[model samples]
Structure formats: C-alpha cells, structure tokens
Target chain A: MKVRLIDLYVAFLKIGGLTFGGGYAMLPMLQREVIDKHGWATIEEVLDIYAICQCTPGIIAVNTATMIGYRKRGIVGAIVATLGEITPSVVIITILASVLTRVQDFAVIQRAFGGIRIAVCALIVQSVLTLSKKSITNTGTVLLFLASVALTLIAGLSPIAVVVLAIVAGLIIGKVKERRAA
Target chain B: MIYLELFWEFFKIGLFSIGGGLATLPFLYKLAETHPHWLTAAQIGDMVAISESTPGPIGINMATFAGYQAAGYPGGLIATLGEVAPSVIIIIIIARFLSNFDKNPKVENAFYALRPVVVGLITFAGLKLLQIVVYGEGVLNGRAMIAFAILVVGVLKFKKVHPLVWIGLGAVGGIFLNLGG
Candidate 1:
C-alpha cells in the first residue's frame, strides 16, 4: 500500500486546515481520513500513533501527520505532510496577527478583547479541571500535584526543572515498586 | 538576531512542551517573563482566544503569533520551523526504527509521574492568566468577573458547545456590556 507524497500532503492539509483547538480535537478527522477514507492505516495503528504523539514533545497533530506520512512514504512523506499540516496555521495566524496588531488600539477591539479575556480564563479553568480529573488518581499523585502547584506558584521554581525532577521521581518510584513486586 | 532568538526559544519550547498544546502555556508565560518586549501577559490572553478560534494547533499559532510580534512574517516562519524541527527529527528517527516506544515499563512509569506534574504546571499558568484578566493591579474588574463566572458555568454545563460559540458570545457581551478595561 504505497501512498503518494502528494496524497499525504493533501490529506494532512485538510486535517490541519479544518480542525480547531488542536490536540485531541484533530483525532476524529484524522481517523476519518487516514483510517476510514484512505486506508493508509488501521484503527489500531492510528491509536498507536496517538499514544506516541501524547508522550512525544511536539504538537500532537503535527506528530500524528508526520508519523503517518513517514509510515506511508518515508522521510520525504513526513516532511511534505508536516508542511501541509502547518501551512494553514502559518498563513491564518500570520494574517490575523498582522491585522490584530494594527487594530489593537481601537476601543471597540479592547472591549471585545476584554470579554474574550474572560472567556479565555474560563477555558483554562476547564482544561485544569479536565487534566486534574485524569491525572490526580492516587495519594502519591495528589501530593505531586499539590507540590508542583506550590513550587510553581509560591516558590517560583522553573517548570522545566520540575518536569525533569518528576521524571527522576517516577523512575525511582517505579524501580522501588518493581523491587517490592519481585 | 531576533529571528535567531525566536528560533532558539521556540526550539526549546518544541523540545520540552510535552503532553499537548496546552502544555506550551507555561513555557510561553516564561517567555513573557524573560522577554517582555516580545510579548506580554495580556497579549498571551489574546493569543489564546485567537488560537482557540482559529483552525490550527494552539502551540504553533502562539509561536507564530509571538514570532510575528517579535520580527515579522519571516520571524513567524522561522519560529514555526524551530518549533517543528524537533518533532520532525525525533518522530522521523522513531518511525525509521518502527518500534512501540510506549510499551517500555520505564517509559510508562515516567509518564505516570509526568502527567500530574504537567497538569500542575498548566494549572499555574491558567491561574496567572486568570489573575491578569480578572484582577489586574490586584483590583477585581467587576465586568470581567461576572463574565468569567457565567462562562465557567456555561463551559461546565454546555460541555458540547464549541469554544468559538463561547468566544462569540463573549465578544458580543464585551461590546454590549461595555466591558472596557
């Protein structure tokens, strides 16, 4: 099942151009095009790609597109698909950034932004709740969550360092648990 | 020089912002702290709104927006390239090998610890934004507070509604409610 580079580009282009809010929002469209429409990959394959995308350090949508394209047509496929995916974002945001900056000083725009700002706050709160529901499962994780919040908010520790420390903590906890089980 | 800096900064953001698009918020906030001339806290609020409403990854859009602010169109291009370079390189290498990286026990445990902490980081960033928009100068803005309350309820209740709808309502309300700050 050889997929043309052009086909890969077009498929991801539609995926990128249509989906809003990114992340999981792009999943349905991705499944539709890659699995249902083109048969480029199976459902399980798409799910696997998604799992990899979650842990990987990049935009999930771009990662998904890159992985799928790479599977279909190697490195060139990955590059082409990535370009297709980001084209919409670069174009749309560049235009909007230009226009918004120009008209940013207007009072009406300010008031609109005022309202938009509140909406943004609400959106962030929802994400916090959603992520907390998924992440805070046990007492250990609870402590980790609280400590992280305190470190960032109260102590002003760098999050990058916190992330690194958490990785170390996880590795150690995992090793200890493995020893106990053995 | 700005382009190089934007490239380097976003490259770091791309390399470390694991979890998802929202995960980039903390790094962007740090960017605001370190390079206030490039962008500000208020501009980040606006970027979130625009990114959510637009058709793209929020992380990429933010990088592009910030890059554009820093330099211009070329800056946006360079910043985006920097952001995606790591993804392209890492994923390509993994795909070449074609193994299930997530199946490893150590990888699984690392994620087990990573998720909760990442959530904490995102929560902190959200709180900072909330403070800036709803209580800038330590004085609560009444209209923004009311809008915030209503939107929170709206989001929780009408979970199916797209964010664009909420943003649209907010814009209209901002104009009509005279929510000028």
Candidate 2:
C-alpha cells in the first residue's frame, strides 16, 4: 500500500506536537510512531536516520521528519512533514507571546520556570549519556569526548570551533583508515 | 540593510549548524556576542530558557525571538524562514542522492568517523549546560544541589519512566522546596 502525503503530515504533526525537550527527547516518540505505529521504517532504519540527522546541518527533528517523509512518500512527503513539524511551535509561540506579556513576572510562573531549568539539566544529561553510549564505542571516541568536555567547560572555547575541529579530525581519520586498508 | 543582514545571518546559521538545535547555540552565542549586537548574553540565556520550555526547535525559537526583537513580526517571519530554508533545500537534494550515496564506501567511512564527533559535540553541549545550570550567576545552592542529585539518580536508575514525569516531579519539588525556604 502506498503511503499518502497526508499520512506523512499527520504522523509528523503528532511527533512534533507532543514531543518535548527537543530532538533527543523525541526519539522514543518517533520510534513509537514510525516503527510500532506506522511501520514506515524499521528500528535500524530509524537509527540510521537518527545518525544522519545528527550529522546534517539543520534541526534534528526537522531533518528526521524530512528523511522519514521522503522515505515514505517522496518529495511531497518531505514538504508536508516539515510543515507539520514546525506548525505546532509556530502557533504555540504566537499564542504564548500574546498571553505572556502581562503576567510573565508572576511569582508562580517564575517558580515554574525555575523548576523547568532543573529538569532541563536532567534532560541534557540524559541526552549526553544516550548519545555517548550509541556514538562513542571506542577509546578514540572516549578521548574525543573528554577533550570536547574540557574545551567547552575548562578552556572556555567556542563550540563551533570544536565542531569544526572535530569534522576536520573525522576527515583526517577517514583518510588514514582508508590508506591503511589500501 | 538590517533585514537583509538578518536573512543572511539566519541562512548561514541554518546552513552550518549540524546536529540540531543545541548545536546552533555556539553560533547564536557568537552572533549575539560578535556581530549584530541585537541581544546580550543574559538575553541569550533567557532565550534559551524560553526556547526549551516552548514547543519548537531551540534554533527556530531563537531566530523567531531574535527576529521579533530586531524587526517585529515581519522580521520574525524572515528569520524563521531563512533559518529553515537551507535544511529544506539540502534535504531535498540529499533525498535524491541518498540511495546511490548510501552504498559508497567513502561516504560510509566519513559517516563512521562523524559518529564520534557528533557524540563529542553533544557531550560538550550537555556539560556546558550543566555548568550554566549549576554554577552560572544565580547559583542553585545546596538545596538545589540535593534536588539535582535526586533527579540524576532517579532518571539513571529508572530508565523506563518518561522524562515528562521527571520534569513534573522536579517542578513540584521546586514549589515545595521554595515554599519552605
């Protein structure tokens, strides 16, 4: 059976509308929707998409939505899925902006956000651990992780510079491995 | 000149920020610090808080908020579209090429190499955020530290529990703790 663009749209809309804590937080939700719910892709395929989404230059949720959409229903699927993923945020922010101008300083709201800040920290830690287990499989990777942590936290280096350096390191490593095999 | 610059700046951000919204933070931090002078570091911190609590990608949330700051609604539209445009275009291109590209050995090697780098960046992001949350200007203090320790243990031990539950518990805990204080 051929998947329709509308199906892709609705699936992504659900993914975007409900999932919180950004891209990593959306993984389980996406797994449920795409793997168990829709059968659009296998778990392995989803993992691959996750890896690709991480490396590509864009929002991970959007990139994952686009990839899954394209996988399911081609170009039209991509467009609809992207629109679906973004629609919730756009609408919600607009509403929040209107309502928040008046009572943003209320003590209750401040307390709520203070709570959220702590939760955000937990989410970040969880994301790091999850990604580390999946991505850092070797000593080289461990060293890289340590170096990156040090650079950002201790050295006060720019993250962009670290990312660039990492990419260059990847290229060099790839060349070296290729030469060794050859 | 400002609108044009805004469009170009966001476009570049969309083009280069890999590994998702948090990945864009470094660039946005740089942008706020160096170029446009549209926002202060504290404002960026506030924007991050707003973005996290809100429904969208942090990058998009930031672009929209920053755009609104710079040129109101129209500017927000411009920034959002500009930030999203690159991914939309590149994904389309990659979609067309992905099948043939998937089997290429060099591409595979490149991706293999990239895995570690992505992890490193993500780890760095988490650490930086932790530093900010724990030790930034308004410190969380000893009470907050106890709460954070509990959260970490709860999450790591009970991996099956949903994150939203953790967030909810943290919120309730904060209310009670702050009330007591």
Candidate 3:
C-alpha cells in the first residue's frame, strides 16, 4: 500500500505522454490510469480532483497531477506528479524552439495541423458535454450555462466576468441550500 | 523595444495563466490588441489554430511561437520558461498545504460553483471556434456544417468512441473538404 515517488512520477509520466489535445483531453487518460488502471482512486475521486484542479490557480493538468499524487502519497508526490505531467511538453518545446525558424512555413505540417484543428474543436465540444453532465444536473445549472453562452457570444463579455458571476451565484445557492437543509 | 516587450508580456502571460494552456487564449488575445504588437489579430487566430494542432500544451506552444516570432530561439525559451514558472511555484506550494486544505467546505463549495463555469467557458470557446471554422477565413463552406452534424450525432449515438478517433477523422475530413473546396 506504500506508494513510492517513482510510482507517482511514472503514473503522471504515462498520463502526460499518452494524452493529446491538452487539459480536457487528458481527463479520460487520467481516469483510465488513476481509476481503471492503478485503482489508486475511485471515479468520483478523479472527478473531484478534476473539479478542484479547475478552481485552483494553475494549469489543470499539473494541478490535477499534483492533487492525485498528493492523494496517493504526500507533498513529494505532488512534485513528482507535476514534473511528470509537464516534462514531455517542456522537452519538446525546447527542441522545437531550437529549430522553429526554418520550418515555420512547412506545407505538409500545415495540412496536418489543419486537420488537427477540426479534431481539437471536437474534443473541446466533447469536454464541454462531459463537464455539463457532471455540473449542470439541475435547472439553475442549465440557466447558468445558457446565460454564460449568451453573454459570451452576444455580449462578447470576457470569460473572467462569467467565471466571477458563476462563483457568486454558486456561493449564494450553496448557502441557501445549506440554510434550507438546516 | 518590441522584442523585450514581447518577452515581458508573454512572461506575464506565463505567470498568471491558470487552468492550463487554453486558459491563456484570452490573455493572448489581449496581448495582440495591446503592447508589443508582434502579431496582428489575424496572426493570433492563426497561432491558436497552430497551437491546437500541435502536441504540447496550448500556452507553451503559443509562448514558443510568439517568442520565435519576436526574437527567435532565445525568446521562445524565455517565454516558455516564464509561463511555466507560476505553475511550478504554485504546485510546490499546493503540495505543501493541500492535505490540510482538501476537506474544507468552502473550498469544496467554491469548486462546486466553478465546475459549471469552467464547462461554460470551454463551451463558449468551442462555439467561437466553430463560428470561425464555419464562417471565417478559409472555411471549407459546407464542410463545417457537415462536421458539426457528424460531431453531434457521433457523441449522441456512439458516445463511446474515443475522441482521438473523432479528431483524427475530422482532420482527414478537413483535408478532403479543403481540397474539394
């Protein structure tokens, strides 16, 4: 039952190396590893980590990694997990930076990316639905979703505004529900 | 003046962009509009397209791309490192305190509130991208519509196909549609 630092590192490394399309895309991979593969935590624990990761002020992938690692081990686990998650991107970017200038306009690369863009769009949409299923279970949540969409698309409001508003609304709702239950 | 400013601007972006790389887009959009002026709005759009397609985190790809545009390799390194610093420091701190902090009710409620909002923000971003894909420059006309239809049906019906498959198929579809158009 004792988890080593290397176990934490390898777990996150596997998570980082396999995931594509970034933060949201990594969710399924994390679920597979943490919940399905390792049995380190349950699906709810993974979801809770994901939820906490979103609210905290850092990269979701790194944050989630730290949370999961800490859950499994301790503070050291957090360090290992964050490092494991980001190592691939950091190394790749370093290499790409070295030669970025010469191939900035490569055509086949552009075509491949052109296709990748569509896929990113789909992935983003899929993530939205997945999150919605979890968070928007009630009418108020649905209202928030619609209002957020309208504000973003029509009013062209900054996302920060929507986030702030949602936080305030959530606090009020949470307090009211608590009061009612009490 | 511009290159230094680009470095500083992206450094700030790197420092504060929480929740991952996609979270940095709003900041990048602001950067395009404000100081440095290294890239036009259109170029920022293109950068986003490229970042999404690449294998790395969106923020790192952007910082690297922007740095490369402004001052070559060194610039890319500085920007990438700068963006990463905040997360590194914060993760270390969170690691120190997270065990004691995890069960706090206020923290839990705050996350409960934030979850739907994150979904909303992500969904809004997707919609904006869809608009660009369907209506903006270089769109493959009806292909955007077709892709949307397929995505909706695929998710609703199968719901089990790995998203990477959808993305891979979409890429092929985009190429064919682009060629056809």
Among these predictions, the greatest TM-score belongs to: 1
How far does residue A162 in candidate 1 sit from its true spot (Å)?
A: 1.7
* lDDT winner between candidates 1 and 2: 1
**Model 2 TM-score?**
0.76
Q: What class would a CAPRI assessor give candidate 3's docking?
A: acceptable
The CA lDDT of each predicted structure is 0.87, 0.70, 0.65
TM-score of model number 1: 0.96
Full ranking by TM-score: 1, 2, 3
Which digits, one per residue and each the tens of the lDDT, describe model 1 over residues A23-51?
88998889888889999989888888989
Worst 10 residues of 2 chain B by lDDT: B39-48
Candidate 3 colliding pairs: A58-B19, A115-B171, B14-B83
Each candidate: fraction of true contacts kept? 0.81, 0.45, 0.44
Per-residue lDDT tens digits of candidate 2, residues A1-182?
A: 99877778788888877776577778888888889988999998888877667657778888888888877777788878888887777666555544544565777755654555566567666766776787788887777777766876578676667766776777687889878989
Question: Model 3 fnat?
Answer: 0.44
Residue B40 lDDT, candidate 1, scale 0-100: 92
Q: Which residue runs does candidate 2 get wrong by more than 4 Å? A: A1-11, A18-55, A67-77, A154-156, B1-9, B25-78, B138-140, B179-181
Model 1 segments more than 4 A misplaced: none
Please give, for every candidate in the order listed, the TM-score of chain B alone compared with the true chain B: 0.95, 0.68, 0.65
Task: After the best TM-score superposition of candidate 2, give how far the Cα of residue A114 lies from its true spot, in angstroms.
Answer: 2.2
